[model samples]
Target: MRLRNATIAAASAVALVLAVPTSANAATGDFLYKVGPGIPAGLADPASGECINLFGATEANPAFAPENFTSSTATVFLDFDCDGDVFYVMNPGKRLGDRLKLRSVVFS
Candidate 1:
């Protein structure tokens, strides 16, 4: 009877310890961009990076100048200057190699 009661008590303690995190206070942190499956996302794909085409030329067969979209992509931080809208590509794992490519973006 003593051994069985001891085993039950130990199991109960373990369960309570594991459940503490869920009951504790939550934390807030800066957002990090999540890349694609192969490459990091949010980080603009430099293969076609450029100043003028940051938004994209869209039509006119390149518009004023012929540019490539992959040459100037970069990693950017997301911070709100004031009351405005913004978007971030969220990564589940947020691995280094995988966070540089564009993944599913989250918008507010």
Candidate 2:
């Protein structure tokens, strides 16, 4: 659902919008990218078949895979701060909230 800022009641009031790109890019190889938007909340299980191997990934930092998220697939990416529910994507000018499907994906 696309949530408008509460203060936009006035007709003259300009709505603030954040423009986020629909796609993201991550490097390839050993770097374990923290894939999110999996079925269950939290990092994906390495054993699960969804993880992608980020070439030079590390515990603190990991290589990631780019995702082409659609309306049905928001799959927002976040750091450890997304422990509970909801995460903020730094992309600018985007409206609507897509359920984050956290998945730890590995690639060949």
Candidate 3:
């Protein structure tokens, strides 16, 4: 009986450990961009492997001049949902010109 109880407790502990979700890794540093003619605004320590829509972004007034300071590569999209054929892949510590407009971004 004692051995059976111990086995069950060990199995339960293992199951619990396996069921716990792990945290996703994030890109370190800021992802800066400008809205219209405004000053640069950014996300600090943004999460990787997720789509991030720029704040206050729209078709007429999209975010532009992206500066990717994060450790991972960033993909900027012309659409809010990170979709469409218009996209730019930016390397870490790199930046784009003001002509490059974007509404969403994803990091790798």
Candidate 2 lDDT, tens digit per residue, 11-103? 224432334343333322121222333321212222222333333333454223334222222233333322435333322123333432322
Candidate 1 residue spans exceeding 4 A from truth: 22-108
Q: On residues 1-108, what C-alpha lDDT tens digit does candidate 3 reach at each position?
A: 999999999999999999999865899999999986867789999989999999978888898999999999999999988999999999999988999999999999
Ranking by lDDT: 3, 2, 1
Candidate 3 has what TM-score? Answer: 0.77
Q: Which stretches of candidate 2 lie over 4 Å from their true place?
A: 1-58, 69-71, 80-108
Better of 1 and 2 by TM-score: 1
TM-scores of all candidate predictions against the true structure: 0.23, 0.20, 0.77
- Candidate 3 positional error at 26, Å: 0.6
Q: Write the per-residue lDDT of candidate 1 for residues 1-106, one digit (tens) a residue.
A: 9999999999999999988875222112232332222321132222212211222212222111111122222222222221124222223223233222221222
Top-TM-score candidate index: 3
Q: Candidates 1 and 3: which is better by lDDT?
A: 3
Off by over 4 Å in 3: 1-24
For the record, the alpha-carbon RMSD of candidate 3 to the native fold, in angstroms, is: 3.1
